[model samples]
Target: MFCTCLCLVLAVSGGVATTTAPSLADKHNALGFRVFAHLASADRNLVFSPHGLSAVLSMAQLGAAGTTDEAMKRVMGFSLRERGASRQHRRMRRQLRAEEALRTAGAVAVERTMSVEKAYRRALSRAFGSHPLQVDFGRPERAAEVLNAWVADHTAGAVPELLAPGSLSDETRLVLLDALHFRGLWKVPFDPRLTHRGLFRGANGSATPVAMMTLTGRFNYGEFSTAGGEDYDVVELPYRGDTLSMFLASPFEADTPLSALAADLSGRGTPEWTSRLGSVRRQLSVPRFAVDSELRLKTALTDAGLANIFNVATADFSRIAAHERLCVSDVLQTVKFEVDERGTEGAAATAAITYSRMAVEELTLDGPFLFFVQHKPTGAILFMGQFNHPT
Candidate 1:
């Protein structure tokens, strides 16, 4: 799991149609990828689900007010201010759940001592579909055990533990727990018989032998460039439901850093890139990988334009409860994923990823690259990552 954003901002409602998809999906995507670019560095295998993070944060945003509210609004670029916003969010949930292949669960755990407003509680249930939980933050370890138990139960033990030892403290007032599990089969499942050993070259020309899965089929594919003129290729591997798909991008030049491609993906170019992709036949090679990450996101979120939510002096959450002036203590996340010949199977991954493409053939991700698991119907990115040093 990989992501960080301080808080969410809810807008006062407008008349937008609830039948339409939430425009905020794009903003949610933006928040995720922006954080990815901020965290991208040498030799890290990052995995996160931005859609899940946004959903959890929206629960908290319903309780924000004043400067804290305004700050997040300016940063997230999406708001539930309009009367229709809530409807839109619900539509997204319904649209996402239309596929039984994917399962997601969320809950908001608030400090037991704080008296959260009933209105805020209702908003969480109505707008975000979250299960409300209250625990004793003063007893961080026991609180963690409760949260971990819920996560493990929902994720089938894939994430038996999320909160690290001492990651939570007495000062903590709120924690959001989200878990998503997806076992997607390729539209055309990869042939296990074709899986063979191949070398995945890494930074500085280091190569690790890996099991490479191969497929030659028609797919939505394209090639595009970054603002800095770094060229890259992309291919879409649709799941059985067609509502979700996996998109992969890699630099055409082996020497280029995955970060260059990551920057463009999290920016305005990403949506455009995906829109331009057309069906083409190609021979594709991708490594079998399993990645699980636990991250503390305060630094990454601050660097990614979410700096105000963690500042005690400036942070505001009065709309939530009145026990004390509550402020963010930490943003913790964990992500786990696996990919192989049976098709991609794993649970959890998120955000800004602007991308584009024409057509390409004979593509192989035998080196460092990027991957996104996207909800096609909503255009919301469920997972985002920079694949380097995968195991």
Candidate 2:
């Protein structure tokens, strides 16, 4: 089926005039960076994009995008508060409070900015048109071609021919397509020759052999013991100015029933810990796999207090010309990740920016995984989540 062409109508009427360039906050940029980072790790075989989300927020702040100085403060404040709301409910509450404060003070002007972002997204849609997912035994080969083409096109061919369109179904179209895609390589590559198998403890306390990629280099890192009955390790992988981290934790060997540790770790709060680095070289192994899943991010985002966007009746995006109604149509994110001895590499692309790269090697995690994407300059948790399974 042909996708709709959500093109931009440049023809303008005299009443509503559009502004040239509006001020934008570094905070929004930083926040966008972090969100993209975490999605990159979740899977290495698909594209994880963050355009739609970033555009909406940026657009809302167009005219009154806070000054860089003020933006930095707000950005920092968000990060500090995030440390406090480790749980979903608390996190949502915290964001709502911040957004309300910005609105109450008449400081954050994002409406105009959002308008521009929306138009840009529409242009992207038309430039690289996409087809809805469809599957049928009779057209299995064609289905694979369709899926592979979308993935390659979105990722700019970095992750070539990754998905088998044949695996999709007409019902797949029903699933929300919101996705975040990233692609990059490690600052330090692991020796592919040194790769070896090591034991990885599963959620059920069973041990299995996993291919671990190893590396030896000075890395920014943190350490801590969680009240959740686990010892934690935080390693930072810095990019051109952005940095993302992986937090690995597991029940202290002496801790009681392993299941009990899992329960404790699930609670949310500031991830209590310490930071440091040392001269260390070790063998590491990780599974080579890709994850492709569709999420109804609308619910999660709405549950996080962004109901106005989903509820067209309440959405306040009137700044885009005289149009009185605008709400998020849908949020589609797809992420692909892969890791081996040479180093970790993956990509996360969304319909928003089209594509991004996040690659790292010489990476290893021997415990529970908790990762966060942060604007290296501002410690904002654009996105945060934990992975307990190998998808």
For residues 159-179, what per-residue lDDT tens digits would candidate 2 score against the true structure?
Answer: 444433433322121111222
Model 1, 254-294: lDDT tens digits are 88898888887766545677887888888888999877766
Clashes of each: 31, 65
Distance (Å) between predicted and true CA of 55, model 2? 4.1
- What TM-score does prediction 1 earn? 0.87
Q: Judge candidate 2 against the unseen true structure and give its global Cα lDDT, from 0 to 1.
A: 0.34
Residue 106 local lDDT, model 1: 63
